[model samples]
Target: MIQRPLYINKLLGFKDKQLIKIVTGIRRCGKSTLFEMYQEELLKKGVFKQQIQSINLEDPLYRDLINWEKLYDYINAHLVDDKMNYVFIDEIQNVADFQKAADGLFIKKNVDLYLTGSNSNIQSGQWATLLSGRYVQIHVFPLSFKEYSSALSSDNKFEKFKQYLENSSFPYVLNLNNDKKQIYDYLGGIYSTVVLKDVIANKKIRDINRLESVIKFMTDNIGNISSIKKISDTMVSEGLKILPVTIENYINALCDSYILYKANRYDVKGKRLLKTLDKYYLVDIGLRYYLLGNTKTDKGRILENIIYLELLRRGYNVYVGKNGDKEIDFIAESIDGTEYYQVAETVRDPLTLKRELSSLDLVRDHNPKFLLTQDFEPNTSHNGIKQINIIDWLLE
Candidate 1:
């Protein structure tokens, strides 16, 4: 089994803390697997099996325990006499008024609560109001480049990276053995489920066609600036009458489901955030390829998408930086410092390299600036900007 230390270590650090550990991410992104690893970790630490209560609400056996009161009663029944219990509830969103049950369980001195879900609703709005500051969300992303590379046939970094980009960071695809049709079919199901069950059904969106149109446009235009007005205009030009407000709601549903992430624009010169334009990157690259069916055209934007997720993994609050006339692909701000990045497929060509670095040159900050590309060259750094090979960066 692949030991995903990044997530495992996080769960270990927060074990038995007062705040509930909530794992949120795209469907099948290994949230449940993380729970399994944590359970094993507990056993290895000499915790008795009886003290761990794992409830998968989606299972037919637990179908009757859909209400918060019943689910709480079921968990309470599993509690062993006078032992510290670790309660793991997978797909907690399956339970109606799940927050009530979680709040009840959280107050138990003997219980440590852990929950996983494929939707962001657990982290926002009505749920947010109920939980307040009592929860810590550990976002579970698909496998990282390093995790993906560890399963490769050989230790060739380039080959592993090429495969990572092609096969994607999704965990299940690692077992598909590069079967294009099978991979597409698997990801297509995940996409449809997120759209149909999570977004459309949950949001009660009537216009499925318009929602899909918005998705297609957003998927095709990854890393590009997007606005409701612009999306509505583009769809209308294509003979689809999707209103700007409707587009906003659809994007919210997609983003709330963890299928897409929106990065708002920040005006660096003004030191203020711009709410008008934003860019949405998918939770996984494979999903984009599966839904859009063409990865040939926008290689740079796809690279940007990968970098966007990577920055997120590295614990940075990423945003699109607009500096006067130029734009930085990502302005990642962490507690320690801020870093600006420009992503490109290759900066080998002189003109292309110039264009890629031009934005970084505009930034006045002394913090590190980077230009990430796939092609490797000895003279990678120029004019205070460091050009790192994308694969090497991913591995690092």
Candidate 2:
């Protein structure tokens, strides 16, 4: 497995803490493998194997332990006294009333609990009410560009990046050796499982065709500002009778499944979040290519999608900035304060560079600003804003 130090460090940081650590992401995004890697680290640190109880609820061996009482009793029965027991449960949502089991385990001073789920619902509803502030969530995404590059033997980053976008970023794809057919097949299985099991069945939607249509439409338009009415109208014109309300629910389901992420608009001048014209980005660009194929190759938007996910991975609450009539591609806000970003395919043309920088110029603040592009050039500063090569920025 390719070591994901970013997430592993996070897990280590919270080791032995009182709170429950919940790792969530789209299915097949390496949540299971992450647990294995972290377990190895624990053993290296001299944590006894006997004190660790790792259970994958998806396995048939645990089929009989689906109820909260039985699951809690089974784990509690195996706990070693006078030692810190590290407990990991993969896909905890599979167990009925799993939050009660988690609450029970949390009360035991000797147990340190960790969980993995494929859906966002694990963090909400009854789980939130029961655990309250007693748990911390660590969301896992597919491999980033830096992680992807580290797995390849090639030194040419530009070519590897192109292959990364086309082939897929899910960790297992690296083992396929750049075969397009096999990669597509692997991505297809992931897509089907995520859609059929996580989305359709979990959301209890009867219209698989309409759900897929919404997915295809959203996947095709990743970086564009979109609304429910706009999607409903487009699909209607395309011969699908999807209502705005139903479309809204479908979009919400997709976001809940981690297949799509919604970035709400932030009014930079007004200093408030707006309710309309939100932008959606996919969890993996490879899934975009798998669903829509190579025909809709809008390089600029694709680059924006890549940057959006990177900002998210870097621990930023990303938003689309609305500065009066001008638009900033991203307003990445974190504990370190807000940063502005604008993405383009290339800014070699003087007119194009000026047009891209104009939006950042409108924001009269001292916060850090950046212009990211595909142009291979030495890093330069535009007044206070910085211009960087996207690939170099990703590696950094």
Candidate 3:
């Protein structure tokens, strides 16, 4: 079990706190592993084995806990009087009225609770209303480039790193030998489960076929601007009767499932986020390769997707830079008011380099405006902007 310091730090902060520790993300994205790490911490800290109870509601062994009362009874029976108790629940959403169970455990003076789910629709109003201001929600994503490199302990680091970029940062794929077919098959399984279980099973949807089509379209157009009107038009051309509102609803369902990511357009010239169209990025890149064969078409956009996820992992509020007529791949600003970045595939050609640099020039602010590329060369500085190799930046 490799330690994820980022998540560990968040978990450690909640030690013995009254607030419920909630970790959410797409399925198989290391939520359960983090819980295991936390359990180890408790044991090392001299927490009695009996004081800690971790239950996976998804397991068939817990079938009797189909409702809140059964769950409450099981947890209440384990509670020790006048002693601090640690409770960890995995896939808590599987239990009906999960909020009630969570609330019951939370109100007990001796219990410190932790819960995790693949989606946020676990308990609608009660979790927020009852536990309001008492719980902290931490989002966990797949491995970052730094985490990915650490996972691959190979002598040939660059080769392994390249494979990580191509394959993905999914935790399960780390054990599977770098076979392209097997990696994608694993990604497809995760995708299907998220779609069927999280989206279709939980949400109100009239047509599963149309929902799947919309998801395919979103995946194919990762990093490109999209609109409901455009989607409706495309479906009409394909002879599929899909309404614009229906397309919008399906998109919402996909987002709810944590399968698709949507980025709103920020007009740099206007200095605000625009409402017309938005770009979409998948939670993992390997899934795109699986669903839409290995095509060299749109490698630039795909590279953009990779950089986008990396920026997010680094704790930056990322957006597309729109400087008058020029467009920057990314405009990342950290919350601490420290860092900023602008990514592009390559700036080898003078005209292309100028186009990339031009976007940074418009933002006269003195923060870092880096131009990331695939080219291997010395990091260059032009007009107060720095240009470096994207791979090298990821390593740093």
lDDT for each of the candidates? 0.86, 0.91, 0.79
Candidate 1 backbone clash number: 0
Clashing pairs in 3: none
Clashing pairs in 2: none
Winner on lDDT (1 vs 3): 1
TM-score of each: 0.95, 0.98, 0.92
Candidate 1 residues lying further than 4 Å off, grouped into runs, are: none
Predicted candidate 3, C-alpha RMSD: 2.2
What tens digits encode model 1's per-residue C-alpha lDDT throughout 62-143? 8988899999998999898798899999998888788989999999999999988765565446556767899988998898
lDDT of 2 at 179: 88
Highest lDDT, which number?
A: 2
- Worst-scoring 10-residue span by lDDT in model 1: 118-127
Flag regions of model 2 displaced more than 4 Å. Answer: 123-126
Q: Evaluate residue 219 in candidate 3 and report its C-alpha lDDT on the 0 to 100 scale.
A: 84
lDDT tens digits by residue: candidate 3, 25-89: 78888999989898888899888889988888878888888698999899899887778999999
- Name the candidate that leads on TM-score: 2
Model 2, global lDDT? 0.91
What residue pairs are clashing in model 1?
none
Error of 1 at 53 (Å): 0.9
Which scores higher on lDDT, 1 or 2? 2
Write the number of the candidate with greater TM-score, choosing between 2 and 3.
2
Global fold similarity of model 3 (TM-score) = 0.92
The per-prediction tally of clashing pairs is 0, 0, 0
How many steric clashes does model 3 contain? 0
